[model samples]
Target: MTGHAPRTRWTLRRRIVAVLILLLAAFAGTMGVASTLALRGSLVGQLDTRLVSASERAAHAPTRADFPGAVGSDAQPTEPTPSASAARPFSLRGPGQDVGTLNLDVTDGVVNAGYLDDNGDFQRLTDAQATTLAATPADGVPRTVAIDGLGSYRVIGATSTAGTLVVTGLPTAAATATVAKYVAVEVGVAVVGLALAGLAGTVLVRRELRPLNRVAATATRVAELPLDRGEVLLAERVPDEDTDPGTEVGQVGAALNQMLGHIEQALAARHESETQVRQFVADASHELRTPLASIRGYAELVRRLPEPVPDTAVHAMARVESETKRMTGLVEDMLLLARLDAGRDLDRVEVDLSSLAIDAVADAHAAGPDHLWRLELDGQGSDGDESDQPDDDGPSSGAGSAPTLALGDEARLRQVLANLLTNARIHTPPGTTVVVSVRATDDVVTFRVQDDGPGIPEPLRSRLFQRFTRGDASRNRAAGSSTGLGLAIVHAVVTAHGGTIEVDGTPGQTSFTVSLPAA
Candidate 1:
């Protein structure tokens, strides 16, 4: 398998500066190369012009007496004039001839070549160098060639009227030096310009992006708020200067501000709707209790009447009493939920959770004797004694384990346990074993209720603690009625006490854990 290369996430500022520098360098390099080439061509053209003049002068200058030979002095016969120590000066070594100028004279298949040095001294060429110069055709057109001991030269050949061939050349050292120096200066200037451009571009880009950064900061603040429930005050907004809508960043800032305003209005509407619904449930539940209690009392009175009543009427009264009790419980649960939603403060007092767990398990066993119930402390089983049970005032310290204390309302905490146990009992079959446990850590006290039954359905696990979320056929095996608010009340109570609840619905190991701040 091929591995992907890691991508570098360069910020906008860095990317802009880098591209700017690269473009500047490319432009500078192109211009430098073009100018250098032009300068070299101009310098070579001047050398070629001088070469042609030198060739013409050599072709017309006076020659020797015996034959057309060396000029400028009175000396005649010579076989091979290979050295500059001749008594007579060479014909081409006259005035107006520059330093490092080369000449070749060819007559009757014989060649003589020499050059003038920087000190006005004449120097003879080696046989190899003379052969290279002689190869230049007498075509009057200049061409560049490299000699043995000399550097580059621009040479041209001309045929004199005496049928003698003259070749003249000049060294190209000055022009090459000029171009090299120019290149050095140009490269240095380009480097400095690129650096300055990069710096200026970075500063300008950062300054231009400041407004976008501000908009992002505002968005980040809004994202940190708790907008999932309750009355949320969305007061964060982009600054007015950043919301001009004229530039790109400004347009983004303006759009964000508009979106935030819309979200604030939506949150306000949602809070208002939730408030009205909660108020209605509270009022209705309050109005329901009196009538439900009165109906139950009447049914009980009729069932215990002194006079004889019909057996059918007696059975109907019993059913009515049972239904009334169920309705009363439902109303009470709804009222408690409404109060919790309204953010009512609960009594914060220290309570031993280990003793509370033991008492709750005892009560659950009494209520559901068909299901096996067990109590544990810190993961170890505990045979809870009556003496350790909590009294009407509060929980008593239980033996066999240290008391795991938590800060919460005692009555609400007790109700939390009762609801959890009732949910397990009403949902699972008779053979299911339910375990209740309490544990404490340095920061929190934990209460866990686990049942070894068929796990909850996958679809229901997400909203299991939401109100009126009943179990499906896989878990609802028992005939006992379920109003579906048991887990909801447990969750609401835990949250009101500044705690958290979580569930694990692994098959045959469903568990709910509540964590509260330790006292």
Candidate 2:
């Protein structure tokens, strides 16, 4: 099963702003709720005060007729008339009266009341409503009462002038409307305030975090640099002003700059060491060539001397010649590597790789008769098509001409194929099958050397192409092997031709692939 990629997370600026916006929204909501509640209580309190004042006026209101005795709670009561206002008692209600008035008469052991509904019509209270209103204590303090068909009211109960229990009330619609208006206003203001806060917060936060972005941008640039191999020129660094050590961002930039500086110094030292090594090899190869030639000449001269030399002396001279030849090959390989490191130019010519692989495999078969060798051309034909065949000179001598060609030094290319074949022959046991396969496409060419024998061990394969790298005593060399520089020389020459080479080895199969760009 395939795993999904990780989700991209929010940026620091956006995340921080989101949290801030949530906190502000919560604060605004809480404040709006608190404001609405405070305003509701204030409006209710005012309405209750007005109700108390109206009740006081009705409790001692002017009587419709004269009574024989002072009216008190102890005397018999009569029905009470509802008033329009405190100042204009018994006056007809006008447009100014938004306050609903109510009067309840609890007299003669019965309860009756008349209250104004929302339509301004005088509505007689039901017996239950009257009883509920009359049951309020006659303490002259305001209390809440609900009359059917209307809404809630703030009412005050008192003893009327006729010694009956009377209650005066005002519907709480005005106070409720005032509270609602405040709530609406609060909502509008809260919305606008939160919107403005979000916009301003975003802009300010982005500006404040720009320094951190600068630091991050520098890090990204460093990450993109190719610092894994070769001479690393780390000339890039945080600017001087950015690298000040005072602020947080400044301190980070300064520290990064210091680290980069150290890395540059280390790379310079490493490059210096490599340069010294290359110079020594080049100078040593040039100095040793003459002596090696002299040694070979002296051995040949001593071996060809005129009369019957002892068999022992002849054998010693032959050994000296062989050792000189091997040393000469080693010196040549080292010199080639140094020259490649110095970037010496090579002769570039159109060379056919199919011809080269065939020639090299033939040479390998002749040299190691115990091993099987074959060449497989990978472009146009593998079954000896007339067009892709090679002649005595090269692949171009075929009936139509070979198309699998590359641009490189022909002698160097031949040496590379020869070395690969030699490595395969020497490493594998007798009767091993070795194949040199050539593949050519529109933009590139590949030559793969494959063998079926006891393949290269995993542990030594990684360093197989390094200078002086050799196999174990049993697998390193065959009878006529001169030096272990075969694979090393192959790698150096391939790289100098601007190509690549790699090897893959297992128990029963091993393939070395050399890829070169097409000319």
Candidate 3:
């Protein structure tokens, strides 16, 4: 057993939306990161400036017990010696650490101080001269140092006093947390803004694509058109009257509608040409049949004469005679169609189609003694009549009293049956069974002829009813028969009588059905 394949899927809409959202997200993310970095840098720079100013003021401050100017009746001043600890203001805090001071000793022309804390605290002096008071610096310059166990710091030497340095250290944790907080806020805003942007993008995309959707729908309806009808029924044309010609979709719709109009006109012309061809065939066939029939009859008469006809003459005459007969048959078939086209008035008598069918089948069986013939006449009722009066030429048995009656020409109808029977006899092999059936309802009558024979070849089915179209050309040549106008006449007559004929053929069986209006 074979399994069905999965259907193909399309994702144009989803892909479009996804791309738009991705672009918005990328833009938002870049902007948010840049903004956050700039804000954090500015905040940190301001904090660093404050730390430097506080350090400068602390470095220049006087000792805690300074006298300034003291007076006792007359101003008497005593020289004051600064305390060693106060002068240097250096306090070691283990691990080579110092508080309120920075060690500045030039060893190998390089100043080395272990570390300094944010509150003027330093530690981890590495040299003996690291704690000594050095000469006053000519210019104040802050140098960066790493405390013994802390992070990096900046220290500035004072110009007013020796060995005095203003120390300020920056902690990694505090600065890092401040920057992280700024980034977090920025990320949150970016996420929310990206979502809103995506929503807006979707709405904008749909609005922008609305006109295209209309164009697509119009195109789909046009594509579904039945071009064989020679007319386009696209009531909904793409509204291009007001659209800009330069727009992509507008141009497409305009071009398609233009093409459709051209196609419809071309189809109409083709249909007119075909109708003319069928008319010509029907007319020419009618005009040629009578003369051909006369020629064939005369030729046959000459061959049948016994007035010392030579053998060569007889053979030649026989050939001419057969050809004439074939040509005559072809002409008669065409003429029948042409007469129908010439609007030959129908007799319009209420004839029983079922009775006609039974007689036709019986006649076919009698003529083709080697073949089986079957008739199924459905004697169903028509309007206001339970019984149909059978004509003398019609069936006398099998068909019930109440048969399927139709409003038609009885002689032409019989001719139709004869053509069908002859066609089946000629096409099918000997001993093939032929089935003839008639069915009737209140409004319609149907006659069917079926034969069990090597059915019509597939290649010839399309043009089976066309004038001069023969299925087995070789057979026609061998039998010296068949002008190929029988089905064409059948089609024309049925159509003229406001009826329909159809053929279904396959290996071993072929069926022809004609449907007409019931009386």
Candidate 4:
């Protein structure tokens, strides 16, 4: 099977209008032909009736005594009279090979007659038509025929009182000529109508597509937005207020504008994020260099000593080792966050989150026994409503079950718990209770770590998850253990498991919530 490549194609409104016009013209032409034919038939019928009436009037007319002959024979007048209007001559033929003549005259508003020889051929008629006329019977009836001298005519002959065939002829050429003239006019009218319709259709089509043109122009301007330079400067958009929401063109323009807005916002966010990442990397490098240089300098001093080192020198070397370990830990945490930012995949398994939280709280208590630790595990089917608990109960569980079964990389989840526990341990003073609680629902599992320590300050809360961000400058100076990367690593690990972590801090309490998707 052959596959088609994707391509953009434009639809021309003018062509569509042209097609509609052609179809209408075709339908109109058919109707015109039908109407013309019907009119022609009616006119021809009237002409035939006129011919029959003239024949009947001639057949009943009184014959003059001076003209006498047998039916289908010729008669000649002894005296001839001249008149301003000359007679139109005609002939009638009988079935017995007899022929007669009639000279039609309209002089001074009176009909006159003359006779001519049957041997004279009709000058205007074709030979074939004249022969056909000559074969007709001598019966008294009107017959239609073509004459050599007269074109097409209707004729009738009957035996008069003088025993001559009284024949009358009416030329039909005038009726046919009139119809031909009408047909030419009809064709001219149709042509003019088609041309005007096409021109009008083109104008209408363009007017209808004006909105689409506006949309195209908007898109062109949007394409020139400075997204690469970390700036968004697109302004032109189709006006939603004026456009009809129901039309296809309007819908398309609206949808395009919506998509463009979304793209602009996303680009702005990405640029801001990139700037933050750069700053983080710069700060982290500066922090790492101090410890690294100290370790290197101490090692060099121990190697360059002229004699065996004293206890003071040995103690100095141990401090250098401790600083090296701290530096290594900080570096490892930063590397883990970088990997998570790069979307590195982690090994996933089913781990009991309840067990994990319990272990973390226990370790925090062990590290700082002066700081009170609380563990609340809402067992299965217990009404774990945190809202119903008394204020003195400290941290409580939400409405959910224990043993939150979550599918995730267990090591990463443990790391997230450890970071939260460590943050609570270092920030709070003695006697401040740190609480860890676990709750599960049908589709998600949540853990909350709250502390009654000097909660995070408002100004510093925004940067709590940022790498190397410390809540209190005094705390940083006092404790070298807090490298200010614990919460950042916690954020990375929780996010890697497709979870959300939130930090809410106030005057007397601070809580960190991590919610993960259930298995």
Q: Per lDDT, what order, best first?
A: 1, 2, 4, 3
State TM-scores per candidate: 0.86, 0.77, 0.57, 0.44
Models sorted by TM-score, best on top: 1, 2, 3, 4
* Candidate 1 residue pairs that clash: 64-69
What value does the lDDT take at residue 45 in candidate 1? 85
lDDT of 1 by residue, 181-235 (tens): 9899999999999989988999999999988899999999999999999999999
Candidate 4 Cα errors over 4 Å, as ranges:
1-308, 380-401, 474-479
How many clashes (backbone N, Cα, C below 3 Å) per candidate?
A: 1, 0, 8, 15
In angstroms, the error of model 1 at 248 is 2.0
Give one digit per residue, the lDDT tens place, for model 4 in 372-398: 776666574333433332234332334
The residue-level lDDT of candidate 1 at 392 comes to: 44
- Which is the leading candidate under TM-score? 1
Q: Which model scores highest in lDDT?
A: 1
Which stretches of model 1 miss by more than 4 angstroms? 1-6, 65-91, 306-311, 378-398, 473-479
| Prediction RMSDs, each to the true structure | 5.3, 6.0, 12.0, 18.0
Choose 2 or 4, whichever is better by TM-score: 2
- Model 4 worst lDDT run, 10 consecutive residues: 90-99
Whole-structure CA lDDT of model 4 = 0.66
On TM-score, the stronger of 3 and 4 is 3
lDDT of each: 0.82, 0.76, 0.63, 0.66
True-vs-predicted CA distance for residue 27, candidate 1, Å: 1.8
